[model samples]
Target: MSQPQADEGIQTSIDELGLPLSETTFVVLDLETTGTSATDARITEIGAVRVRGGETVDEFTTLVNPGIAIPATVTLLTGITQSMVATAPPVEEVLPDLLEYLRRDPGTALVAHNASFDTGFLKAACERHGHPWPAPPVVDTLRLARAVLGRGETRNHKLGTLAAFFGTPVTPNHRALDDARATVDVLHGLVERLGPMGVHSLEELRSVTKPPTKQQIAKRHLAEGVPEAPGVYVFTDANGADLYVGKSKNLRHRVRTYFTAAENRQRIREMARVVEGVTPIVCATELEASVRELRLIAERKPPYNRRSRHPERVHWVKLTTEAFPRLSVVRSVKDDGAPYLGPYTGLKEADRAREALLAAFPLRQCTHTFDPPRRTVEPCVLAQLGRCGAPCDGTESRADYTAHADAAREAMTGDPAAVVDLHTARIRKMSAQLRYEEAAALRDRLAAFLRGAGRSQRLTALAVLPQVIATRPGALGWETGVVRHGRLAASAVLRPGTDPAAFLASLEATAEHVEPGPGPVPRATAAEGELVLDWLTDPATRLVRIEGEWTCPLRSAEAHAEMTHWAHGRAPAQ
Candidate 1:
């Protein structure tokens, strides 16, 4: 089997998330402080024991002059008086050595009985004295003991109670070093208890105390087969029906997160309860994973996926193919050859685009279909208002009505200068007259039209292309994709040191054959086409070959992006 390559800037290995407890290093530490509140406390002593595989490797102990009087209550508790630390180094001097000890072993997790109390004082000291704190992974034995041991097994989860229950050789004294040593043994005891519960890895150990739902725990096995790589994952039910579809750069890590308490989304938790299996489809790059995820969600319409499941529901402003062409808001694009202005996600935006086109050109806005030469019926109030050419009556000739339809089509498909210029002039006139609200409304309508027009133009540009081959550098080799008609036809990773030309030839031969369809994005959904466009326009992507022109209209949405920003009551980009 071919090993999956890591996409650039992503870690595609499970090592970090799957490091076994036996192979993990832990620095069990305790701090003696003057007060309980971390913000008000000052550390007087620090004690730590570095251990791996349940064996002690080294120890760190220190006394620091806290530069503040040690409270009598604290002194009574820990027994280290001010005079005891009087000749000792100040906290500023002690922090460097302590930080060094923590940094000596990379990937070492910190362990403590009441970890927050200990870590808080140390972090406060490091911050006060201007020493950078090494924020290591922390394991709180107090929380772990509470999570693992029953009340019948232990009276309390205190350090002394746990140490006595575990029968550790070292008992917790008031002093820091003895307490740290006792905590280490307690940690080992907790680990032993967790082992049978399947908490074997350090990552699991960290989140085990919080505990996932029983359903999540039972479904964890679903993540076992997912490799750590950029991919799309589908969670399916017992009947093999898709429940949810997701994409991730690290499939193993992301899938495992769902079975941990870290994944707190309530909907996902419910989905986890019914998830019978996970299907992982590895890809050559993150872009391909994203595209595939979009395609799968659209195809399966999974219950757990809220977005992209209803691409067919996307609204479009279509110029109806009738005797008198009028703008119509539609749910789906068909191969009827009528020009469409959008895959608009909202009906209101499509209406606004339709209104903007009608405002610019005197096209009929009514749903009435005319059979020909002209009707003798009375025109609606819109004709008297001059918003319509009154094609329903004999007032507007067929040739003149056809001219308006042609201009509207040009604005929707080729160039939007007429619509944009008219809206701009209207907005300027309204602004000059201090009718700002009406002007803003017109601006919104104009922006909606431009947005749809720009998107339609961009997608049409890519959809017309017969083929486009692009590549970008990946961690293991060259990440490449063959796109035809705005859809991903094939994708692969050319291993490093391989001949690029030969790989390209092989990829082109095996690429999926896509027959061009009608509308903006023929072979794929608009969302998928947009994703492909994003990948193609990425600065890192290089065009290896192109079968036809791969360019947007000279005056598409991008050209007026700043103008739209200004229209939306914001300053244009500098």
Candidate 2:
């Protein structure tokens, strides 16, 4: 694909838009059903004609035994009586043939007068008969007529009206094949009308029916060079500053929607108007595209792309590096050797985890530092209420405070049984005292702690591994990834019949060397690690090699599962 020059200024040639309408295959179809409601209706007749460049290539027509009597009203309207379908094949026997006809040519668009009605009945038939529905791109002639024709040019946007207006040789008479043949002519007429309005390609034709805004129509050229493959896309301003970052499996189709009325978000529409150019970076697979998208959003911090920009802003519950250590919610994890509990997405959840730790241990909540161990003459409210041992006031000895800090560290890193027991006991006591709200609040705090602890343990299990190589079968080949310390170091797609062992060795040799850092995710953000972990845990994934054990503690997993059940109002497993 040729890249557009910077000075072109959005003047798109009709040839660069997409597949031309003249070269596109259209399967114009019509269906006669027993009723209008898809759920309650049965298709009695299916008729479709394949047309290309204003010429018919093939035709398909079939009568289906609905197995249900056709209503008298439906019989009068469609002339498909019960007797006519009694000798015909059932829908199950006819659907496979129709599906095969539809898939005969790839990129064939399904055209109908009111597409929803016909497509709805067909989809319902597929569902009822346990057949897979081939979800095809649809073009409704009625919608096209409404968009292209003026009110004075047509009486109504119905099939018969369109047939009369277009001077079609075949007149629609509510019979499937005849209506289908008439619709083919009507479709050609609408396409002819759209030609003069810059709707030359299939993509433009689809968008033109939406009657896109002026900004959208003007900026449609930005999507011209994007290839239909999985990858990331960056939208930039004229000055080359990043405006937005996104990813899609089909880069061209997804990018084109932004220049059409289908993109309904106001912010996105405004972003589309200011977009000066689009940069497409094609990837080997969808997973690679997702990981790259996350990394780009974090690195660029584009104004239009929300989420993942402030990955470092995540909160962590840490044991503060002070003489009298206490649980504190910090925004970052450093290599200070202090135990960390989480990489929580929200400060509120981190605070809840901290509160849960404080409930179990009498750790100081104050932000004061005591390097020289200065003692206060007056104790704070927490100390007076016996919630704290008044370490600042010298009521608590250094040895006693050390013990509390040790237990807190253990709860954060190792076993959390002490904290769980303390909180559960408090909840039971509060419930017995008829303080339902306080009990509920305590339960929430405990749940939050469990969630953070569980996530931290799961991530640490993967982050501690020096290297892990895994693969899964892809459409064209095998998709493989090299991970180091829970970060995606490298990824590749090996063509089918390629030797897996050799490919794995080559990928590992050139993969990124990740130096171990601190916290749950040693070399990557928590979100990125989670994405990698999801890929690793998929049942289809085959573990080729591992440098270290990849497992979470049984107790931690159980606690997380128990908390999940309790949070959802279900009884915890025995």
- Candidate 2 local lDDT, 1-574, one digit each (tens): 9986653322255434666788899999999988899997778899999999889999999987765668999999988887888778766667879998888887788999999899888888776443568767678888888888987998799999989999999999999999999999998888888778767777677766654567776787798879989999999999999999999888988888777644645688888678899999999887889899999999999999766898988898999878899888888878888888778778887898899899889998887767765747567899988999988878999899999999888777767887788777777787677675677677668767876777788888898899999889887688899999989999999887778778888999999999878779778888899889889999999888999888766667236545533321111110
List pairs with backbone clashes in candidate 1. Answer: none
Model 2 lDDT, residue 573, Cα: 12
Against the correct fold, how does model 2 do in TM-score? 0.62
lDDT of 1: 0.82
Scored against the true structure, residue 328 in model 1 reaches a CA lDDT of 89
Which residue pairs show backbone clashes in model 2? none
- Per-residue CA lDDT of model 1 for 1-574, tens digit only, reads 9988653322234543466788989999998888888887677888999999889999999886765678989889999997898777666566778888888876788899888888888888765433557777788999989888987998889899998999999999878899999999999998998888767777678767654678886777777878989999999999999999999888988898787655655799999878999999998888789899998998889999887898888899999889888888988788888999887888888898899898889988787757744456788999999988887877898899999999889888877878878888887787677676677678768777877887888899999999999988888788899999989999999897788889999999999999988888899999899889989889999998999877766766557644544223221110
Worst ten in a row by lDDT for model 1: 565-574
After TM-score superposition, what is the CA distance of residue 358 in candidate 2 from its true location, in Å?
0.8
* Candidate 1 Cα outliers beyond 4 Å, as residue runs: 1-211, 428-437, 564-574
